[model samples]
Target chain A: MQDSTATNARDAGRAAQRAAEARPVRIAIDAMGGDHGPEVVIPGAAMALQRHPQMRFVIYGDAAQVEPLLDGHPALKAASAFTHTDVSIKMDEKPSQALRLGRYKSSMWRAIQAVRDDEADACLSAGNTGALMAMSMFCLKTMPQVERPAIAAIWPTVRGESIVLDVGASIGADASHYVNLAVLGAAMARIVFDMERPGVGLLNVGREEIKGIEAVKEAGRTLREANLPNLDYRGFVEGDDIGKGTVDVVVTEGFTGNIALKTAEGTAKQIGEYLRSAMGRTWRAKLGYLLARPAFDALRAKMDPSRANGGVFLGLEGVVIKSHGGADVKGVAAAIDIAYDMAHYQLMRTIRDMLDETPIATAS
Target chain B: MQDSTATNARDAGRAAQRAAEARPVRIAIDAMGGDHGPEVVIPGAAMALQRHPQMRFVIYGDAAQVEPLLDGHPALKAASAFTHTDVSIKMDEKPSQALRLGRYKSSMWRAIQAVRDDEADACLSAGNTGALMAMSMFCLKTMPQVERPAIAAIWPTVRGESIVLDVGASIGADASHYVNLAVLGAAMARIVFDMERPGVGLLNVGREEIKGIEAVKEAGRTLREANLPNLDYRGFVEGDDIGKGTVDVVVTEGFTGNIALKTAEGTAKQIGEYLRSAMGRTWRAKLGYLLARPAFDALRAKMDPSRANGGVFLGLEGVVIKSHGGADVKGVAAAIDIAYDMAHYQLMRTIRDMLDETPIATAS
Candidate 1:
């Protein structure tokens, strides 16, 4: 009976080891990125480790600052491999200037470089978006057939969530750039939503074919003609359609996309302000708010911007996730969660496969 | 004592008559416009007349349909002179097609023509925006020194309201067009908000000078260099700034402005849905909601889109207020209120004066 029990235990141990070996989703982090830097990033990483036990991290920052923060979370400390770097990119620094000054030496660059070197499956940063993009484009380069990279955000909608691409990657995009965005966004949507053929939409002022800018019209025409295999081209979607979750992927040039994203955020904030002021106006209202606090908590959870923190840098050869510069620990953790998921799902391979399947005539 | 009272009464009557003559803000209405047409328009006009007793309307529509509706509102019927037109612009007709078919004979055309011919101070229509803009442009012609007419909306912000221009008037704008928008938007702001020099901001992806498209950057440069007397050019503003009321006038190309407006609407709707679902989840929440119903009602009133219904057609030879096509009676009334306000304040005169004051070198 003892021998049989030992054999069963051995078998269980072997299975656990194999699972651990197979699920190593390594993420490189720029520890000195956001406003709080190591204070938020270290705690965020620790929290992420709790959720994803199999995930590993290569954290880049000044050793003196980051090591002390890591000491607070022993489990994360055990799972992480620390890389020391004294240099850090400034939040206000221009992209071109940052690239010149902090290329190979900065924490931001090294984190991205780790992904390029295949030491880390993905890179996560809450740094200057322009600088990060510049470094990412310079280091990782664009994927085959991609002219420019885009930032794809998981936008919360009435019907769960949708992917919105080019949320401030670059300002202007041509017809083909929009098509590329549609393709890249669809690829991300598939992995994130676990859908084989995600519905892709071009974000425009109106849904009519002749209503938008010439570039958008041309992109729509191209998307309709190609009828890409990996994605379902759903044609034009208006601004309101985004919140309605009318499509799985909303594609647009960065200028409009960025404006739309910020506008939504601002609107959400404005409504929140209204709600607070309304509930505090009278004693009866205050009492009601107190009684319905739990419900409000749930509503708050649904509206929490931190839950939708990460923006994946699409069309790049290596995976990179950008978190908001002002993100708290929870926001940073959410970003890490996205990085882990992307790496675990082999996002690059999926993107490559999808791109290969896309007909070259339509993509260009 | 009886003789003195009689004299006072006679003096009061003459003063009232003079005030009526001075405050004649004639508004021409396309009664066949909007989803419900005369059903909403007649009642809306009656409501506006209740608020502004001196206001008169030249209502244009199929007399058979509109006359009965007008009969229901005795006060509006008394104040308004009905104009019969069997032709009306369809909601779905393309701009060019609507112009071709509806010009000269359509209700929409007659209402705008009234403004151009000096029979009415302003024109109000809730019909197709594209069609209305096309007809207004063709009939009224662009004002001197104006390149393209732009639609300006009164956007509700946490801090009162802000004026956002080019809300789907036209798609693309050059640097000069943006400057035109800023100038035109500021002129409207002066009349609407009663400000001497409204703070104007150019909308962009970032507040930084280097961030946006070239046209926007160029506009910023021109505004700064000119430092026009009628507007306080406050560099650049972002999407979030619009809701925060960072500037009195938010200027952008029509495409982005329209999207921002719709996105805000969608976000507001989304939040309302979330609030409803949250309140319905538990008995406790329901009870709390019941108690706080008044507070929620007040919040609803504050967030009501109807209050901010009018989009003033700026850069036109005459004032034209465009209401949302799907607007209810209350929304239509709000639009009429804007038309009355604009006409009473002599909006076109303000625009002409502001344009004359602008440095020709910078304006061009």
Candidate 2:
């Protein structure tokens, strides 16, 4: 069974790799999604185009606002088809409210619709996370066998990077949801990390601390029992394992995952503040900081949150990426880069096939 | 109503302060706890004894193993009464199994029982967290109105330290449980941080996202409406807000709180690794590192995990502290220091009073 599953995955990977090499990935951009809107998105698309010349864009936004910015980037403009929409979702709008106020006519909805219509291979949004997720679910819908969609983040670790999923796409999860998260996250890790069988771990507390939530333990049993070929289930990992790169994919429910993600970001910022305050304490410290400018710059670059900007919406029928609302041009480009890879590799079909192959009964 | 609550708290604080100043705090030492056992615990107790001369100790452990170690610390030996207990809980023992095997005879359980029997003011242990919590709950039990006890950690933040509670004492929490956590955490914060009304915040996702769990929303309403005098309830705070010191006490369920705490620790460690690697990259960086030794030392001191080593078990009828099992002498001393402060301030009575004063009906 394992050998046959391996062979199946290899064939699928090879087929995806070959097709990706032959075609350009069409990305639908919600130009007026984030804080800076077209001012950042247009230039970000231009930057992404430079990295992957085989990328094309289908831009949707208010024409007057986005057209001027698009014209500023000649290369991106030349490879893009522009669509005009007068409405754009507000950053602070609630998910349900956003759906009511701007569902059909909004730039965010239209961008996701393009992907469903087969006009774009993938969709990218830098709007409100809740709004973007709601619209994506409404427009693209969940794939077969997927209970609900999840958001996956590329976490930077000492060993490189790992994929963490269910970072606040929803509130609660059951046993099957955990299994779904593990499978979906593994599929993303396989594509992102470029591995045949990405190791997956269920996020849990210390082993000595009375086993974690019951759903986590149940999911662990199911994953271990099934022993799917495309992914290796490495039992349980604690919160620290995410930064240690102990596994390629860390699966968790949305509530804890979101809190963990935000807490890490907060800690990094706190340390940065401490570092700056320490460095400015004395004249000698200031001189040392100046001399060690390169080291500081390197550290800054490594800890830059924008480098890991994109949050891929998993278990969907079409590829969707949600960039941070406050992300700058570089960060937006990072999101687009993920969209390009995911769309190019046909992640939706990959997830569908993997889901169909998984034994859901084992989870029960 | 607010003014009256504040005045009542102030009077209670003054009475507790006078009583604390008039007497010595006796701490029960589980000498068999932690990795180094009596070798580290004796020295740690000695160190804490130096700073707090009025502290007395009731040490429990295997006399054959602990007698020689105690003799090495003359002052601690003189101030402590030693008891021989051969049974000790293993680091990996399940909570239930630990109870069955080591409940009555073990050093960990006996230390907790001392507080309950009024033989000691407080208890301290560096044994298995789950075992300690189980023993603590079983021996000390919950105070009136507290559904279950919570483990509160003194979290280091940019502004200062914040008290975060329910960091894995138990898995799930209801609205009333959250209220208990908030009240208990605020009582500790008032003693540790020396504040009349320490600002409290409910740990939640971003205000913009869909509202958090139903229990969280319900708790928010309860805390807001009750308007307790001992704590200033500042609506909602996200995970990042913990590090920003946005609130004096950050309240959440054990599952998410534990994950957030561990995730922050992992992030801090990861950045430290990144910094070290960057500093070693070039000769200039090395030279600069040497020149800025003081700055690095300061940052290291700021980030030292040992400085915040104790987890105070709140909502209990008596004070109990769980130190890290892998902690060294300094870390153990830190935990003892917290135990001393909590005992001195009469935390149990403070919590009891607050619980009695709080309108529990509002929580539902």
TM-score between candidate 2 and the true structure: 0.94
For each candidate, what is the lDDT? Answer: 0.88, 0.87
What TM-score does candidate 1 get on C-alpha atoms? 0.94
DockQ of each: 0.65, 0.79
**Once model 2 is optimally superposed onto the true structure by TM-score, how far is the C-alpha of residue A45 displaced, in angstroms?**
0.6
Q: Which tens-of-lDDT digit does each residue in B1-364 have in candidate 1?
A: 1234334433443453344357688999999889889889889989989999989899999989999999899989999899899799999999999998999989999999998887888999999999999999999988656788999999989999999988888788899899889989999999989999999999998988998899999989999999888999999999999999999999999999999899899999999999999999999999999989999999999999999998999988788999998999999999999999888876776776677667744322
**What lDDT score goes with residue A78 in model 2?**
95
**Candidate topping lDDT:** 1
Please give, for residues A174-209, the per-residue lDDT of candidate 1 as tens digits.
888888888888888889999999999998888889
Chain A TM per prediction = 0.93, 0.93
Residue pairs in candidate 1 whose N, alpha carbon or C atoms collide under 3 angstroms? none
Best by DockQ: 2
Model 1 ranges off by over 4 Å: A1-23, A362-364, B1-23, B362-364
